[model samples]
Target: MHLSGSPTRPPRSRMPRALRTLGNPLEWTDIQKTILIFFPPIPFTLFYLYRVNGLLADPTVEPYISRPALATTHSFLVGILSAFSGLFVLWFVLRRREGTHDLFVRAVIHSWFVLMGLGAYLVGPFSTPVLIGYQAGGMAVFLLFDVRRAAQGGLVGLLVIVGTTILERAGLLLYGPVFSSVVFAGERPPDVWVYLNLAFTVVLTAAVLAGTGLAMALARARQEEINELLATDVLTGLANRRGLEDMLEREITRAQRFDAPLAVVMLDLDHFKRVNDTHGHRAGDAVLQAVGEVVASHLREVDAAGRYGGEELLLVLPEAELSGARAAAERVCAAIRALVVEHDEHALRVTASAGCAALVPGQPRSGEQLVRAADAALYRAKERGRDRVEVETDPAP
Candidate 1:
């Protein structure tokens, strides 16, 4: 047996703190990131293979000298791709061995750092559009990882790229290794090189952005769920005390601004302790939950209710005058008196005493003052007799 409005849903199971960080809120799974690690190198390797076959260059328009130069350039690009692929395996190996994500992540952080640096190197002399695109999109990986170590690794990678460009400009290294006057054995036409690099840059950036958008959407949804859990009352499905106070403050501001009448009604279940003592806490809870429904059903959309504490609820009614507020509280009292919560084989019932306090418009009154007035009147109702309503006479703004 259960009360009419008591929450009966099973409680949400909480994940362990460590497991929670793995994917539910923010972190991508190791498998997902591992696939990302594999994808980056494939395109670069294929592009270099195409270069080895002169598929990218127009031999009629570009300079061609030695076969050895083309082979050397192809080897260098392939080497970078191979190095990245070979090292990326550590992310998998260590992930299996340790099963501690942070341990594997820290182990592979430097590998990612080197990959980013080399990725920038392939298109960088600091001024290349492809390098700029890589930097913009590459930051998404760090965002997905979101460990402090990831940040440190990414920063080191960026610094190496920047330092490399500085050194290249100073003639310590080649400026635009692939973009310089004679690229390998044959120089591709300037416009062809530009178009190809631009295409690469666009594809690279778009992939990163698409992945980040999906991951961030998941994180944002989880955050909203957490916020709701923090603010809502699990038992009555109303705002809790803290959330109610915040609402009250905002309503007070609205009343002053729009010259609207506002009233606060504080309701306390009569003989609540006796219900717990005689019928057990479960029955008392049933009584409270049923009464919460009684108060909620009496309210309009503009009205708000919250559990102020045990066996007590506070309602905020907007655009309500003193008499209207008192009448509303009486209705709530009548409704609570009618409630019959069926617990086990017994039919438990409850009654509520309510106090109404209206806002004195154009007066500098705080939310606390309004609640105190209603609270004081609530005690008066109790003193007079249980199951009744009382209106506060003193505005005391």
Candidate 2:
């Protein structure tokens, strides 16, 4: 024997703030951006390798104390390190965990910077001061902890490449002039510093621009979604009254200008109150939603269906004559009466009535007149018996 009493507690159902933020609609777009982050590094590494090889092929090119083999080795190691950093990006894609992906990407980018500093140790030291300035500027912009963190990341990345070139040259400089004589044997190879500056400038600029474009696209997408939510009915996913009115006015103007037929159909669920009282409000809601689906499915793509009010729907059919509109409205009524939705393991059926009015040529058929004519015909359908379609004819044309 069990005793029944009021429940002691309310249901504990709620999502935490952190989880909500993480599951924000924009999160997937950020994931899409991750694919682009790894692209610039590939070309950047290749360009750096090109600089290293350009020096190595020259007979005068020398590594720390005329060690040509060490210079080549340094170039190979830098390429390998850059390639490794790029490969780690794939892991981030596969993982697809936002927090972990951000953390890993940051670590890889920072580590790449550190390697650039190490690469400078292999090549000959700086000749012009501009090259050093390039490295410093890149390091400052990309690695700087500011609001534009990704821009900073790219900047740091470019600087790291320049740093790598500088590190190798600086290494040769500290070692001796023989190292310089070997690397710069006959003529300087267009100052590796110039190449470094160009690489950082071009790559970092592109990265920042690309990030900005992606951010703009995300914002645009959000605006479009908000507009749709405001204009669409949540239950039926059709245009709301405001949206319907706007569209109707536009279609009416176009039809009048072109002398094309425009039709309006106002539909209401018949005996809707009886259904709600007999079953439940849930069942009535189901009936309304199912009728909406049925009506939409029967209509052509050119026609617009909107939820006008409680248990009432409106259809705007352009380039359709009175006959065509009436036939379409009749079909919609039949479809709604045929619709049976399952509720609480029982099949429930409902009926709807429609009233259609068409704009005739040489008549001032405003949107208000068309809708009102349809509404009056809809009342006639209800009077003559529900679940039938009525058309307004003999209008003062």
Candidate 3:
């Protein structure tokens, strides 16, 4: 049965879907929805590589660019294309093999960032706008990969750009290495820098487009983080009541649309008032927080947990039936009985009673009705000597 994930950590599947800024392009982070090695679509990368190849290949493009620069750019493009082609061929041959795609996914994408930086530097002088390549490519890396990989890739990539500019300034390497006779004034290219300007402008345009896309992605991620923070409970680190109600409504809609099963579990602490009376409110708060953690940890990635109220929690399971919901509540009750929260150097113990309710397709029941049923079952658990599990199978409001 499907269940939503806990509060602190969202499901991996949901994380990727939430990043729908690029039309869900290139789930490079996860192997399941993985795209072509470095780029999302194969044609997009091929077109980008070939476009650069054409710029360097045409003598009219750079207007009498040097032989060394010509050969160097040609060789670089050839190598990049060949490497990508070989991988595609390998993937095709082993297409039917079970983990073949996994091997291809390890394709060193960030390394290409450094290579792009080096390549962009070669085509223009130190003052050329192509320098934006580092920033553009770095942002893309930061978004596509995780933090550690992003930092590592970005560090080396920036070093390549900065190191090359330093070398050119020191006369150790030729500025405008790709344009043989291209010379620059202190802060800008010289008057005879017409053709070089054209080439650099093209590179700048590409960088601008890439940077803009990455910036939008950054905004989307940040907004999502802010939204999650607002939804979370300050004390329990679980979804607050509002968040739970929102999730319940959404789950109910999904269940209705897809004819899927839906379940809710309402759990309340037994003798919670007694704990506060004996240990004080601060310690009682600690107990609630600890219990919330336990509940969040016990559920699957598809299970949703939230703080319903003081000493009470709710769980929303997407594809669970009445029996599954009942069993899940029982497991939760057992876990609570075994839990120990240490506050003020004292080992405080607590027990929980839980009630479950579920829905079938075309049940004509609302999420509120489902919650009320679970609440009724929870009251029954309390009446039947507490610290137990109960279920309400009837969908009637």
Candidate 4:
């Protein structure tokens, strides 16, 4: 007999769908994301420029460890040039092109990190810790890669810091004629300084990453809300004309591809102007809203209804033939007749006239053509009598 085996461990839960789809920073639109990416470098570039200007104004100011101020000045100028070059390329060259924009953004970020690392080493030991910390934070914010790529980028940044420190020490030993030539030439900083620098780098990097992530997430959410608002009718809680047109186009494409039937119904409130004159505009609005609710409630899941304009509504029904469309229009007409709106303590009842048209196979039917046919039938229904449904006859060859 075999011995009993140990229990198997449970499988790990997968990441949430939203978190899994958190896109790369480079994938963001060039306008806002690119501007934000370049923000961190602005402060450092300004600081360097200020320092260089001050040193130039007062040439008698003592150099750090017998190193000339000109070397630091040159470093600052290089950083400013790099920052301007990146911005120019983004605005002028990349413009609105996403593919090249993404590549350019990533390249600029990597180059900025390299420039900052080199500047920190050249600036001397006294300022190395601060520069390295800032560089680490900036990299964490601007890299905007996925977890694996971000981790690799972070590792590269760490290597930059450590390698710069080592190279500075070597230069000191070699008596190189540069900024901080004498100070780091002999001895390295204390181990406590190194530990403190690492600690500061880690803390700042975490803060920048978290802050950037939160801001980007909020911006994305706001954009979605704005789009929804733009596509919605404020009064009827239905799709606006523009939104309706978009849905109609998509349904038309699907119907054409599948060789299925598609239908549209155009409805107009009967004697709507009389109601506005007898009661008031507010009462007319209430009637419109009531009509919207009735039409929406009567529609099937595959159908979409939207406000065509004042006193009018349109419906799109996919996979529906002419007879089916006429039945749907009759139901909507009956539903509107049953709706009662209360405005200023007045009970108002309204009726709608509808025209139905269906796609004819082997005939090229467009959204505009279908809508115009329905409108013609609607005009006929009104000419005969209101509160009825009329179906457009087949188009002649």
What TM-score would each prediction reach against the true structure?
A: 0.74, 0.58, 0.53, 0.54
- Sort every candidate by TM-score, greatest first: 1, 2, 4, 3
Residue 22 shift from truth in candidate 2, angstroms: 15
Once fitted onto the true fold, the runs of candidate 2 whose alpha carbons sit more than 4 angstroms away are 1-43, 58-230, 393-397
Local accuracy of candidate 4 as per-residue lDDT tens digits, 1-397: 1111112222222333454465434455644355555565565566556655654555443443233546555665666677666676656656654564556656555555555555554444346445555555565544454455345445665576678677657764322234342333457854433553465456556656676676566556556656666776767777789989999999989998889899999999999998999998877777776777778889999999989998889999999988999999999998878777776777788889999888888777778998999998899899989999999986521
lDDT of 4 at 182: 39
Q: How would you encode candidate 3's per-residue C-alpha lDDT over 188-232 as one tens digit per residue?
A: 654335654665557566756965775576566656766887788
User: lDDT by residue for model 2 over 1-397, one digit each (tens)?
Assistant: 1111112222221333443454323444433333333444566567656755655665543332345545655556676656666555665555555554555556545554545444444442343322453354344334323336556555665675565555546673343222444434466644443564566556656655654554455556556767776778776777889889999999999998999989999999887898789878877776666666677789999999989999899999999988998999988887777667776665777788889898988887778888999999899999999888989966554
Off by over 4 Å in 1: 1-99, 125-138, 141-147, 159-173, 180-189, 207-227, 344-346
Question: Candidate 2: what lDDT?
Answer: 0.65
Runs in model 3 lying further than 4 Å from the true structure: 1-194
If both were scored by TM-score, which would come out higher, candidate 1 or candidate 4?
1
lDDT of each: 0.71, 0.65, 0.71, 0.68
TM-score of 3: 0.53
Worst 10 residues of 4 by lDDT: 1-10
Alpha-carbon lDDT of model 4: 0.68
Q: How far is candidate 4 from the true structure (C-alpha RMSD, Å)?
A: 17.3
Tell me how candidate 3 scores on lDDT: 0.71
| TM-score (C-alpha, index-matched) for candidate 4 | 0.54
lDDT of 1: 0.71
